[model samples]
Target: MRSDYKELDNEKIYLVTGAAGFIGFHLSKRLLDEGCHVIGIDNLNDYYDVNLKKARLEIINKYDKFKFFKIDLQDKEFLEEIFKEHKIDIVVNLAAQAGVRYSITNPDVYIQSNIVGFLNILEVCRHYKVEHLVYASSSSVYGMNEVMPFSVHHNVDHPISLYAATKKSNELMAHTYSHLYNLPTTGLRFFTVYGPWGRPDMALFLFTDAIMNDKPIKVFNHGKMKRDFTYIDDIVEGIVRLLNNPPKENKEWDKIKADPGTSSAPYKIYNIGNNKPVELMEYIQTIEKHLGKEAKKEYLPLQDGDVPMTYADVDDLIDDVGFKPDTSINEGISKFVEWYKEYYEV
Candidate 1:
């Protein structure tokens, strides 16, 4: 909601890592639009397309209140310099080596970026005394758990991919900082975030691109996979609602029967998702309908580090933020296709 951003103190400086990224760019723009000064950081890595990342930055650069820096998160020196340069009231750490399948081949990058980079973020947030730190965690951390609707309270110790492991590690590291340094932190477990300016590596983007060009789209798990495909705007709204409300010490937290999502310390985790899962075929059909094209599907077995379904239990998110993602796939896909057509002139 715009009201949430309007109520925020415009004097507060927000540091957003991965400002060139899909989520980071959108979040940075939203903050800037609300008159909040923002410092953006990104390594500008060629994880996918460097051009696309730069294009996102081009839009963010237009804002007078927004400042951009091209720096890797593992470079703690530069990161700390940024902390010293600005009295950052809030930090949203969205920079990470994304992609589950890519992690299977490139485990080293995951460790370096996701693990070490995140540690640097935690260290800076602890020392700088940032009022709140919000970072991205993924529903991929629900690895191997056959749970229908994954809950934050569920134990996510069985991550199958290095990518998922790194995200889970982020949540744990943030909790440790919250406990040791009294740092306020919140980890959002996002589910299938997609929309215009979205990452090209995601299924929705890949499917759309292939269908538009009349290429055969890879249909994994014989098109039986399901996902809680959340729209980018909804995800941003949920994050905005939580930015000002950092977690307080849960005095009622049961140590005997520990809850993985919350602690006696100032740390909490919530799943920001649509709470409704859609079949892979249905998602593809929606894309096709918007594109006015049919995809040549090639059926395949479930790939490595891939799950058949992901449905989020967003009760905590709804209860805490009084918000729920209600954007239908049809509406979201239609907007994405329109943007795609205009951007690519297809």
Candidate 2:
């Protein structure tokens, strides 16, 4: 644990929704390791794998200061019960139906989980008078923008996918609460996050699984894609830094030339991603180098809900948290491959 962890007020309790999910699990564990009290809630839906979610919970259950709840965000009554039971000072809302392609077919789940569920969270935070609310937003909200590096100041009104639209809606909703209730809110736009215990649907995990099984890996956009692949630890570190540093009212914010990233209200948004964008082929090559196996590639067209490239402008993150996600693709992939092999006994 870092000295800064000890400097934090351990009496402050954290409410982490989606606590069993990939990023959630890592973040909750980090907080627990730092001797912070954590109240974790997750429906543990089969969105990816219930067993994986359970395994994460099993680890978290080890911490004496951690409390687990198997609940859904949509169940506002149960969600509120937790807030009532625990004096949650800071709330991190990571629970959402995540996936671009899945949203194309099953749009209802996205609306229900991301929209309704997030609304519930905001309401609870408002009624409970939580100190700060930090929530997960997606880089996919950039939609069709062809900009090299996506910035928080860019216009994101045109979301290409339903999933992106829901994430955009969450930011809008959060801003409303911040404005109306004077709630302190911060939204993180995470890029391609990959590491050990990552979602099975994510690119790195899919590619690794396919290669390990001697199956063909689907190379989308004919291998012309680029992503700002961020490591999980970097993401956790960014969130931890922001936990104590809530957004303050930007007195200098101009209403005439309003910036979407900051507000006169106590609200802020930061792009938490690796500043470097990795080419799809190069990413695959790194994975291959680590696994010591060649992937059988099957070239395909760009998926409907995905952009050809995603590059994050993390200047705001560095300015705010004094940190930037600098984990290299080779190093991140190597760690993931090592964990994958050890976890599967391959």
Among the numbered candidates, top lDDT falls to 2
lDDT, candidate 1, 1-346, per-residue tens: 2233334567889999999999999999999988989999999999899998998899989999999999999999999998998999999999999999999999999999999999999999989999999999999999999977999999999998999999999999999999999999999999999999999999889999998888999999999999999999999988888888888899999999999999999999999999999999999999988888899999999999998899999988877778899899999999999888888888
- Tens digit per residue, CA lDDT, model 2, 1-346: 2233323456799999999999999999999999999999999899897888888899999999999999989999998898998899999999999999999999999999999999999999999999999999999999989877899999899899999999999999999999999999999999989999999999999999999999999999999999999999999999998898788899999999999999999999999999898899999999999999999999999999999989999888777667888889988999999999988899
lDDT of each: 0.92, 0.93
Off by more than 4 A, model 2: 1-8
The TM-score of candidate 2 is 0.97
The local distance difference test score of model 2 is 0.93
Itemize residue pairs with steric clashes in candidate 2: none
Worst 10 residues of 2 by lDDT: 1-10
In model 1, the Cα lDDT at residue 175 comes to 92
Residue pairs in steric clash, candidate 1? none
Off by over 4 Å in 1: 1-7
